[model samples]
Target: MANSTAKKNILNKIKQALDTPVPLPFELNNEAVNVFQPAKEELEIIFAEAFTKLQGKFIFCADENELHAQLQLLISSKEWMKIFCNEDQWNVLYSNTLNLESCDAAITGCEYLVARTGTIVMSAAQQSGRTVSVYAPIHICIAFTNQLVYDIKDALQFFKEKYIAIPSLITFASGPSRTADIEKTLVTGVHGPKEVYLFLVDKTA
Candidate 1:
């Protein structure tokens, strides 16, 4: 009975919310705000551009196998040779060459990257180490285009109802971690990766 009543209350709240209309300013009666829906290609272009503006970069892959191959390339890339990893780990393939001080970036796969707010969601797991994404000057994430969502609420809802396991650490990363820690000067890459790159795998079948 208690559970039934709780469910009923939730339904009622939802109904009321649906019935409620957003308040409008009194300046002009019946004035409406236009919401432009971005097309698929347009959204991609915008997403990529927005990512670039926020110091984000990306590398495209064809499929899961390609993603793995590309990841291997990234893991051993001369560009980021200063970083380390544990080859024994499932997703971590290069643990032997990490330079703690020189390390300034991370790489991880995401369940999805929310498009509405331009935030990426990464869950903590054995292979998806927290350090790989947080302990660096830059972060690189890969996800398919289909995994993109509109908002955080949708992301959490999908996780709760489908994925079922709540992550020990769920991070909503929008951009590089920055803070005005010392005096008044602004600084970047102090607490976390200062650059983030999202590669959307659209060619996957």
Candidate 2:
């Protein structure tokens, strides 16, 4: 009986609190605030430095031809025969080059490249989908200069403007997956790819 009475009192207090909702303790500011200083170098340069610092391999291509040549060279040098790319557009470019049940590397396109944080923004809306990026032992991204954004906020704004209804999944990949959980010893590629490569094609050039 006593326990029931206590439960009733708790329910009544919750109802009362909901009925008399309190305002936020502080006033909310809607003004836009700049948290970081403006970037001094070009977005591409900034992205390259930041990405390389995170142990990502960066390649700059002047055009699609260069990108193709570089990709071929990397494949030959690394001896990666089973390349996987499901995108029709990319498949057309690298015709007769990509086809394998099991892949040594996976190539994908990203929605945006965040320069400030050196991040790759991807969504379920892309043709490659989610698994292509994380499943492969080596993940390679093909990106254009036009897809570069100054910051994550810019990427979010781009998403807001591009999609009326946002995608179900949005992911940000910085570099090869790593963890320092076990014995505080840093280990890479435990959760995802061991190596990550970004080939940035300069469409503006």
Residues 3-84 of candidate 1: C-alpha lDDT, one tens digit per residue: 9999999999999988996676655644243253433554455556655666666666666677678766765674665544
**For residues 1-205, could you state the per-residue lDDT of candidate 2 as single tens digits?**
9999999999999999999999989888755866788889999999999999889999999998999999989988998877888887686654244443368888889999999989999999998887889988999999999999989999999999999999889999999999999999999899999999999999895
C-alpha lDDT of residue 183 in model 2:
100
Which segments of model 2 are wrong by more than 4 Å?
1-27, 95-101
Which ranges in model 1 have alpha carbons more than 4 Å from their true place?
1-43, 62-78, 85-105, 181-185
Best by TM-score: 2
RMSD of 2: 3.0
TM-scores for all predictions? 0.61, 0.84
Task: Please list the Cα RMSD from the true structure of every candidate, rounded to 1 decimal place.
Answer: 10.2, 3.0
